[model samples]
Target: MFKLKRKIMSKLYTDIFDLATAKVYAVGRRSVWRDYFDLYFILKNNYIGLDESLLMTETRYGSVFSQKLFMEQLAYFGDIKDFSIEYGLGQKKIDLDEVKSYLLKVVKNYSQSHV
Candidate 1:
């Protein structure tokens, strides 16, 4: 039981970080739509602060995360529109454009503050 509890705790910590930190980092390097959706959901739900999330990401990944690259990826969603994936929050459906616009706003705010 102690071993099982430790395993669960380890996974829980990983999930908590992955929810925002890993997703945000992945968005900069890949066009995975799930990364964007997860980020939108995390931010909209107040799961974590963006600055804190980035800090955790940097802690985990060191200097691999570039703020410039992340901001650029967040702003560019042209290719994402061509790809489709089912998305929703609970029973309600979510639109891709809405996610894009919301994240764009977040990127804008983050950029302005960091600059």
Candidate 2:
């Protein structure tokens, strides 16, 4: 009876999926993004989900924000920042204001929703 109870309880432990679920989110690099606002916009608005879809899996963990994931998240929100507003065009040089505006918006949104 004791052995049976122990086996049953142990079987209920949830490590495999629990760990994987816990590892889904990655922390953002605010300083780096703040310093390079334009680059940040390009990355956040265009690159978030692509990288996460590519990199995330049952056995993988990401320590920092991914290039693709960041952009994807940014694109989700359409703020059109300072750098981007001035230089917003397809395949052309990226705008600095656009990046700054987009980064601030995404980061703020992320913080509010996440909390």
Candidate 3:
């Protein structure tokens, strides 16, 4: 069972790395009672936060919104994957194609604004 799980995770990581618009920097596993993976990616100038950070479980279930924005507080924060895991909150599964589309849109918008 553990071997099968590892195989699935390897495939998922490869699929994420193959995305053209986003440059993946690191992929690592973290455990705090349960195991989860964190993928660090670079899209244009964004780093460590926003869409650049992704956290998901071994079964690949997590949030579509990687970051949280609070207008009243004028603050931004990383979405806690632990809550999602605990409460089964993120029903929408992670989709690589959708991620690619979103990253491409960000790149296009950034380029246009700067030029």
Among all candidates shown, the one with the greatest lDDT: 1
lDDT of 2 by residue, 35-73 (tens): 244335334655333233324432354445354454354
Q: How far does residue 86 in candidate 2 sit from its true spot (Å)?
A: 17
Clashing pairs in 1: none
- Give the local distance difference test score of model 1: 0.83
TM-score per candidate: 0.78, 0.32, 0.25
What is the overall TM-score of model 2 with all chains considered together? 0.32
For model 3, which pairs clash? Answer: none
lDDT string, candidate 3, 1-115, tens digits: 9999999988875655443112221112222211221221333324233232333221232432222211111111133234223325764454444443554465455446546
The better-scoring model by lDDT among 2 and 3 is 2
Report the poorest 10 consecutive residues by lDDT, candidate 3.
68-77
Q: How good is model 1 by TM-score?
A: 0.78
- Comparing candidate 1 with candidate 2, which one achieves the higher lDDT? 1
lDDT of each: 0.83, 0.43, 0.33
Q: Which ten residues in a row have the lowest lDDT in candidate 2?
A: 25-34
